[model samples]
Target: MRLLFLTNRANALRARISNTFTLPERFKGTVVEKWAKYWTGLVRDYKDVGVDVVKFGYNKPRKALVITGASLGLYACVKRNPDEEVFLQLLRQWNNKLILVSPTEQNVIAKEYVRDLELVLNRNTLRTLSLGFCTLLWVDLYSKDDCTYKAICEYTGVDYLKFYQYIIDIGFWNRYWRLDWKMRNFDINYL
Candidate 1:
């Protein structure tokens, strides 16, 4: 069972899998440590249940994409048959550097990630990404000013004052010690 991710060194977007998470900014003291322990424990819950969570990041195939002739041929096949497995199989042939999770877990994990990430990400995006993985996938709000941050919080469906600590903790999603989430934010960036 394996989960595959397309990534590049210069830009590790966290991609669609993490789109549902609300990652936190750098924080102080033991704040992050506590949150990390909580997040780790949460993930451990599923692993103990026989779920092997493996996320493999493979660089986008630069040479193949640049070669117009081959790309066209590949594109045609994908267009003709829109099966996801076909696309995944082609991906496997393109890169030898990979760590495959059990394919059996793909659908199940993708689904469970939505429910479980709600707890881990603990913050929702204004809506599902309109562009999905096509856009930059920063999980945390980058606004520095209060007003701007407030607007972002609005879209994320969190009350600024209420989630302030959870949003800016040294740990992104602190479950214990930090204040409890009043509204219970949820995200699916890792699915």
Candidate 2:
């Protein structure tokens, strides 16, 4: 079987392996070169195990696709809109296996991917709900700050009036947005 590995960042392979494995002192190079050598070694190992390895990025191959990265990379592949015909075509042709190797929990990744799928499947309704939630959060926290709201509106391309209407219609007063609860609790230095 053909094996293809996809990662959001090139260093993902190194990061994943470095946690449990030690590199030999003979493997001397810059960080990028070391990673490249490590990746090649991995491919060679797979080859010894009787798996046909396919190169990605340089030449596009029509075979089984292995995507190994952060959840965001998988999200991008699976979340393409119907209008993205070429992407859809490529997706359809491959037997795609996603390998998410990030610090984030698998369940969280799955949940977010599913949520994105839901948004794509029901674009109008889900998009409105998502935008409404974001808009409400921005309004609730930064209403007094003109620059923040202006930047938010500009970034999202959401009209202030429409967002207000959504909030009103959704009964913002009755519902808690939980913006603070969703904040990343862990320190970045730990990662």
List clash counts for every candidate, in order.
14, 0
The residue-by-residue lDDT of candidate 2 on 1-191, one tens digit each, is 12334433424664776676765566556686678777879875765454323344235443323344444554553353222233233223221222232335333533344344334434322222333212222223223233655546645555666765433212122232231222123112232
Q: Residue 24 error for model 1, in Å? A: 72
Model 2, residue 185: displacement in angstroms?
20
RMSD of each: 28.3, 23.1
The global C-alpha lDDT for each of the candidates, from Candidate 1 onward, is: 0.36, 0.38
Which regions of candidate 2 are displaced past 4 Å?
1-83, 87-107, 124-157, 160-191
Best by TM-score: 1
- Per-residue lDDT tens digits for candidate 1, residues 1-191, read 12322224212543443465544555534677688658767865764443221221123445535665676865554445323233234334322211233434334433343334343334443121112112112234433333565555646644456543333211111121111221122222234
Q: How do all models score by TM-score?
A: 0.17, 0.16
